[model samples]
Target chain A: MIEVNDLTKYYGQKRAISNVSFKVKKGEILGMLGPNAAGKTTAMRILTCYMPPTAGSATVGGYDIFDQSMQVRRITGYLPENPPLYTELTVKDYLMFVAKIKGVEKDKTKAEIDTVIEKASIGEVRNRVIGKLSKGFKQRVGLAQCLLNNPQVVILDEPTVGLDPKQIIEIRELIKNLKGDHTVILSSHILPEVEQTCERVVIISEGEVVAEDTPENLTARMKGGERVLLELEGDEKQVKEVFRTFPDVTAVKVNKTAGGLLKVEVESKKDLRKDYAQALIVKKIGLLEMQSDKVTLEDIFLHLTTKEEAA
Target chain B: MRKTLAIFEKEFKSFFYSPLAYVIIAIFTLITGYLFYNLLSWFVEQSFMMTMQAQQYRQAPPKFNVNLHLIRGYFGTLAFISLFILPTITMRLFAEEKKQGTLELLYTTPITELQVVTGKYLAGLALYIVLLIPTMFFMALLFIYGDPEFLPVLSGYIGLILLGSTFIALGLFISTLTENQIIAAIGGFALSLLLWIIGWGATFTGGTLKPVLEYLSILVHFEDFAQGVIDSTHVAYYLIFTIFGLYLSLKSIESVKWRT
Candidate 1:
């Protein structure tokens, strides 16, 4: 539902984003993973028709952002980093005003508001002033505002930035439920949050797209195929040699821990924990701890972003 | 038009919800009420003096126009008070949105800049009109007690509304230039006061310079309407001035979008 090509934006002499491009398919939840200042907000701003890109162009719902901005804005709902709210107004009044501006029909304004209020689960606080509400409620009210007009595209910029863990989980669930109905572009620095909620992830770093794929594919495609950790009472060199000689073992590293135990990290294409545990016993190397873990999005993100910085 | 009305409705209702609007209206009514009372006393004292002189000289009292003596002075004071009060009203128009980050919501909406500016301008103008309400009660007192030429008083109000529009439009433009409400209020007040008094330079200069200064002065156009004259030149001046201010506001909004 959205296509961005070489979108660049410069605030005066400082370039906020440069030649950044990405796409979101219809009814897909695409997560934009990036640290702060990674041009995520800037890209979303350009897509929402909040501001025009300095170079190149974008189209939303098959309408060009520059020439058909009204159409783009009409169909796209945006929630900026800070929830745009009037502190003095009640939640219902605020939603009613937004509906009028968003062009909800006069006859349906109240029903449309009721639907959003129910969706964001803010019905309990519907009559309460927004400023007096809790942060979680305020964030949900922001989300409720986006659901107005039933826009085909919903773009949220760091929707769960400062929320507590429970609120984050609730928000993630709400976003996950938006699948197959509304095209969502969510930007966040939290990798696990993206991994859990998004169908596809776009890893952005230094104003560039480093990787774009499913979370599973991203973790699997990075350098580490499989990883095994072993804490043992043995010579570091002997432990490394054994894992190096093991079938499908690609690389191994050993370091001494505080407890006088050798910590061995073995990266291989295949799992050999059962075989390796037996071999260690036969070699008379005492095993204190043995654990195997799959590569996570955190590992891939760090590797991709840090590698880009190094180059 | 519907979008503009939506913005206007929200803004207009917000003014009543805040204490600043009530304070401004209270202070404005008190000052104008005091001036009207004092003017009424002066008019009565002057007429009493005229009657004494006529009776002593055995002659009829000459004509004394209440519209000139009372209504004109009341309208002038209203115009002056609005210059100060309107800035505070307009100060919060765009500055508050910018300060609270609601400008992002406005920009992303499908509404155009013209609609936004027009809606805000109308809201401020409406409040300025509301500020004139108490004084209207004062004007009604004059009609109940004595005969005053109604057309002159009517023209004076038209002039006051026009002048208020000029102040509000200029102040609205200033609000768009900053996120700080204090700065917007102070900047708008200073610029408006400067324009109101810019014609004073006519006293120091001669030839073509004097006319230019007088023509540029916002107060000069309103002075004609305050005195009961409805000259088309003065009407054109105020219309042009208001449009120019609104034009600047629209241009500034556009420039902000393109402020790369």
Candidate 2:
């Protein structure tokens, strides 16, 4: 539904984003993961037709962002880093205004607003002035505004920033619920939130796409394979020798303690826990515990982003 | 067009949603009312003395034009009051949107920059017209107590509306330049005052420059309207000025996308 190719933007002489490119398929939830100043907001701004890019181009629903901006704007709904709201207006009034501007027909505006209000779970605060509402409620109102007119694509930048944990989870669940029906491009620095809600992610840093893949594929590619952490009560030298001699074992490190207890960390091309266990049993080496060490998305993000900086 | 009306409705309602609009209107009416009352008393006192002198000397009393004495004075005071009130009305038009981050919503919508500027400008014009409505009641007082020329009164109102709209368009343009409402208000007032007094420079200068200075002065065009004269030249001047101000506002709003 959206394609960004070699999109570059400059604010005066300073470059905000350079040659950044990514795509979102129809009905796919794509997360844009980047640290602060990674040009996440800049990219979203270009996509939403808020500003023109210095070079390259983007299209939403097959409408070029620059040449066909009106079409692009009509089909795409954006939630900026700060929710664009009028404090003086009531939630219902604000949404009604948004619906009108978004070109929702007059006959359908009220019904559409009620739909978004219910979808964003802001029904209780619909009649209250937005200024007096809590931040969470305000954020929900912002979200509800984006859902008006049944936009085909929704672009949200930092949707969960500055929210409490429970609110964050609720927002995450809400985003997860948008998976099949809407094409969503959500940008954030939070790794787990993206991991939990996004089907695919484009990890960006310093205004460039450093890595792009599914969450599981990213972590798997980061370590090359699984890692095993094992504790053994045996001769430390024998334990190390047994793991080193195993065929699929790539590397092993053993630490020997006072009571002949050995702590072993093994990295392998495949799962070797069972094979190692059999080897230890055949060798009469007493095994205390065995488990697989998981590589998280955080590690992969840091590795990729820092590697980009180093290069 | 529908989208522009939506924005217009929201902006117009926003003015009354706060105490700012009412407070400004109240202060404006009080000042104009006081000035009108004082003008009326002075006109009555002068006419009474004229009659006394005519009877004593066995001569005819001088004719007093109520439109000149009362209506002109009322409109002049209204123009001055508008210098203060119109800026306050327009200060929040774009500045508050920038301050509160609602400009993002405006920019991302399918509406063009021209529509946004026009919608906001019309809202400011509407508020200024509402502020002028009370002056009609003041005009009705003149009709009740004394006979006033209908054409002059009508011309005077047309002048006030035109002048007020010109100020509003200029104020709306100024509001787009900053996010601080105080700065917008003060800057708008300073610019309006400068334009209001620009014709003063024509008196001090000589040669070809005098006409140019006088032509640039807002008051020069408005003076004709105040005297119940609807010269096409003056009408054109205000129409051109209003369009110019709105044009600049549209350009300023479009520039925000690039500069920000």
Q: What is the TM-score of chain A alone in each candidate?
A: 0.96, 0.90
Model 1 agreement with the true structure over B85-146: per-residue lDDT tens digits: 88998999999989888888888878898999999999999999899989989998999998
Query: Worst lDDT window (10 residues) for model 2 chain B?
Result: B69-78
> Tens digits of per-residue lDDT for model 1 on A172-277?
9999988899999999999999999899999888888889999988977874567889889988878877786787988888889898899888888888898889
Model 1 pairs in collision: none
Compute DockQ for each candidate against the true complex.
0.72, 0.67
Worst 10 residues of 2 chain A by lDDT: A255-264
TM-score of 1: 0.96
Q: Give lDDT tens digits, candidate 2, residues B1-260.
A: 99889889999999888988899889888888888888889989998999999999999888888998778877888888888888999899999999999999989988888888888889999988898888899899989988899998899889988998888899989999999999999999998999999999999999999999999999888888889999999989888889999999998999888883
Model 2 lDDT per residue over A92-153, tens place:
88998899888899999888998999999999999999999999899999999988888899
- Supply candidate 2's per-residue lDDT for A127: 93
